[model samples]
Target: MTVRPLNSVFIGGRQIGANCLRVLVDMDAPPQLVIPDPDDVGVDSWFESLVKVAKELSLPTLRGARVKDESAIKKIRALKPDIIFCIGSMQLIPKEVLAIPPLGVVNIHPALLPKYRGRYSTAHAIFNGEKETGATLHFMDERIDSGPIIMQEAFPIGNEDTARVVYDKFTEVGTALFKRFVESLKRGEEIASTPQDESKATYYPKGLPSGGKMDPSWDEVTKKRFVLAMTFPPFPMPDID
Candidate 1:
């Protein structure tokens, strides 16, 4: 359904991209709210950064539990928002929670849909030596990252770039793309969501921590791949062998 000047609630963490920020910035549009609580993980810079962004954008945000919390839901529903934007939210939203906002919810995935549809898309992308990767704005479904896609745009992965660089790069691109979508929504425009081609879609499970260590006796190409593959900071690489 086409919506106009929606009251949007931002369900996101520290790693939220620019697109989510834009939605927060629209002139008195949907009052933006943030849920910064982290679940099963230590403090993350992404959450801290999100708070800063909200302040800078002058967007209204409320912080509460990371996952399904009745209190948070009650507050959000009280606002009677039109739509919800989930950005790098660490927890899976419950179906009941998803139903609260009538206009539906949209999530920003770091990887292109149908492929890299789960956690660690960046690592998988680099491990596979993908030359290009982009962001996917899709409907949030019962399955993880398996929703119908609303919009997607690819950015070239530099040969010298590591997963961390790629992650940071996509934030800029993804956020911009997200802003465009918010504008369209405000104008009551409907975006077409292309169902993913399941045949070609691939999902990668969480990689073993030890598996990321650089292999000894590896050739130059393999060594470089090792570096790129384990570029994300949390997944560290072994010292150059």
Candidate 2:
């Protein structure tokens, strides 16, 4: 059967977002509109530019726009996208925009949902001494990362893995999930999703307060994990008290 192309919109930023967007484009499933995080949100040296890649692909790009804003909602509504993909965007997509897409807004999260449900997943997972961490793809709801899960796969976390290492693993698994998702859509298959278990859900707020400072009373092992978890290259490790 010939598959019908999906009318899609993409809201993303960062290296992972750039990579996932390329997957869509390379598969001939590029979105109708690309909404990248504004310069202020994604301009850091650590991240690749989603906007630049969108432009290079000749995709219609929108920047400096928040999905919660009415103006932005109007633009998205006008497109009447069949599906909206939100990958690597830190903002929680509002319900108004979520209601716009018939197939629902899909999100690719760096950590397994219902466990690490926020921005600092890898760091928190590493600091908590988790033996494994993984990525998830889900249909977004009004709440943050508390959506119906489409897919999840876990990878073991090595004893010496830092936040950056776990994050690179997340990127690998997350982008692979994106590839599978797009391929399914290309084949015109109806994706199945399971609602997340609310009881298992946990959230981590953005940023590490006190600069991820280790508590002086923490055990040496705990302190060591904290240091590793907070370590991401191009940024120095948190100062030990």
Residues forming the 10-long window of minimal summed lDDT in candidate 2: 38-47
- 23-57: candidate 1 lDDT, tens digit per residue: 55663464546554444133434334565566667
Tens digits of lDDT, candidate 2, 193-212: 99898888888888773357
Clashing pairs in 2: none
Model 2 CA deviation exceeding 4 Å by range: 40-44, 207-211
Q: What would you estimate as the lDDT of candidate 1?
A: 0.72
User: Considering every candidate listed, which one attains the maximal TM-score?
Assistant: 2
**TM-scores vs. true structure, each candidate:** 0.84, 0.94
- The alpha-carbon lDDT assigned to residue 75 of candidate 1 equals 80
In order, what lDDT does every prediction score? 0.72, 0.87
